[model samples]
Target: MTTSSSSSATHGRSPAGLDVSASFATTLHTPEHIRIAEELGFKRAWLYDTPQQSPDVWMTLALAAERTHRIGLGPGVLVPALRHPMVNASGAAALERLAPGRVAVAFGTGYTGRRAMGQQPVSWAYMTRYVTAFRALLRGETVEWEGSPMRMLHTPEYPRGAPDTIPVYIAAIGPKGTAIAESLGDGVFIMGIDGVSEEVTKKFESVVYGTAGSVLGDGEDLGSERLRTAAGPALAQLFHISYELGGEEAVKALPGGLEWLAVVQETPEAERHLAVHHGHLLRLNDADTAAWNAGGNTLVGHTLTGTAGDVLARVKDLAAQGVTEITYQPAGDIRRELEAFADAVGLRR
Candidate 1:
């Protein structure tokens, strides 16, 4: 089993990373986007894994792998509930073949991927078993799954044989998940700066903080059309997560949460799951738009959005707190967001 150790005190500033939602539009253009990010000195390209909302995560990562030479590539958080452990192991092996040491995989409890399908996140125990089995398969060891022995059957000549190593990161927001991450994951992936606690920074060698929103331009404010367009999709995602985790009462706690709940409530309870996440991280659907028009602007402060300098200051603070990496998910003009953020953070090799 994986266990955490005290990270080296000499760890430097957090490097910048790009997070792509893997929607059709984003997927089609990810190669170019990642190339631009690479040229701009990004450290990694993490594709979201939402089968209901986008193409296959592994396929997208494979495409990205073939296009980029250096930038690290992998899913931001693979939902184990969506695939057997063997399938995930194979997918990681394929990417390792393409990118060699450039592959890194992060596993999560299926927040959007499972919730959108009207299900709860998988238990941490299940995640532990799946990740253990996955690592064993990649190591060319036979592992039992559902009472059957399974292992990679690739010949040495095949490109699918496991590479030297693939670092595993677990996405966690709470203590239970974080504890599991420390015990089982090589690193931990989390959302928001608030997720970067002292215990996490000290426990894990790599703490990847994922955020969405844009690096604001010179004259832009929260109400600026460009800011709205760039930040709306991700801003709305907060409401989706809240509603799913806490239901109507929980959503009512956000800025304009009551109004947002009303719009979501308009859909029948039986099929509300479909209605709540219509656009997801791609665009703001009707309910999300309603939330934005009402008081979503007020929530911008809670996101990664800010003038370039302001965002950079935040990044520096996180680095001081021991965050190893920060992955920014852009909502609009993907290339523009990537370039702007890279420049803002002074990303370089």
Candidate 2:
């Protein structure tokens, strides 16, 4: 189950769920695939977006919403700078209209594609302000600042408004971004091949979440959700964790697997990009395998490089740390990998 369906606040515990996603491929037989995903016991479906080589995240999600009923849907981390906030605001509103009560949005600072295009990163302070403002707009509130009034464009022919009650998840990486997530007092979405340390997670919440003593207004659970406080979850990463632990076969799937191995030897920054780049390369499955392995651009550090059982156990261990949502990028055929995952994690009812 996802935080949306958790229902644990009444009992003083957090709820947990999994996020199944891939950022590449515009259309993955989505109508059929998402249904398969729902049947496989996946909690929710997450989509990703980039300038080139990847499908439009929100567009794919709106399409997927028509296919699945019980599962949830949203962008894993749509970078705000990619387009006008109105684009995101409008797209989200429309998706909610179609899927009613099943839409959520996650915003992140984008790691790879945007930088590849010569775009500068959006400032955290600006993002914090923009997200705060964006949420309000999505809630049917008109926003105005410095004598300028702004409201989303609407029309009778194609009328839509932001859902009054859509959940907002923030993809906060690194210490700074994480702190912003906590201070804002909303769901914090984070996943790193190398687990983002608990101390950092705690420090992040202390600043972002602790800044204000009260849960900012009503209908928001500031204290519980900000720090992945899902109660009783023991294998949140059966999905995302698959990438890191897949080991040799996983590494062999990268764009420049050998190159990344060398880069990480000198400094770990390359490993981080390797995870992002190689994930895109393999998940899309567009690059030739022979070229990818021989080339020097593969993503290697993201690989778990361990036995399947160890990978599954690591995911379980992390869930013990309070992760509620695990977003995984599968290595082989989607259907087969999910089955292997469920068997390893015992995810059946």
Best by TM-score: 1
1-349: candidate 1 lDDT, tens digit per residue = 1112222111112343222221122466677787677666566788888889788888887887777776777888899999998888889999888877778899999878888888889999999999889888888889999999988898778756444378999998688888989888889988773457877777888888888778988777678888878888878878888887677888888887877888878889988999997877788888888888888778887788888788878887877787778888877788788777776776532
Model 1 regions lying over 4 Å from their true place: 1-26
Please provide, for model 2 over 70-153, each residue's C-alpha lDDT reduced to its tens digit, 9 standing for 90 to 100: 666777667877876667888889888777776767777764455434344678987887787777777666877335767866
Q: Weakest 10 consecutive residues, lDDT, candidate 2?
A: 207-216
Worst 10 residues of 1 by lDDT: 1-10
Please provide TM-scores, in order, for all candidate models, with all chains considered together: 0.90, 0.66
Candidate 1 yields a Cα-based lDDT of 0.77
Give candidate 2's root-mean-square deviation (CA, Å).
Answer: 12.2
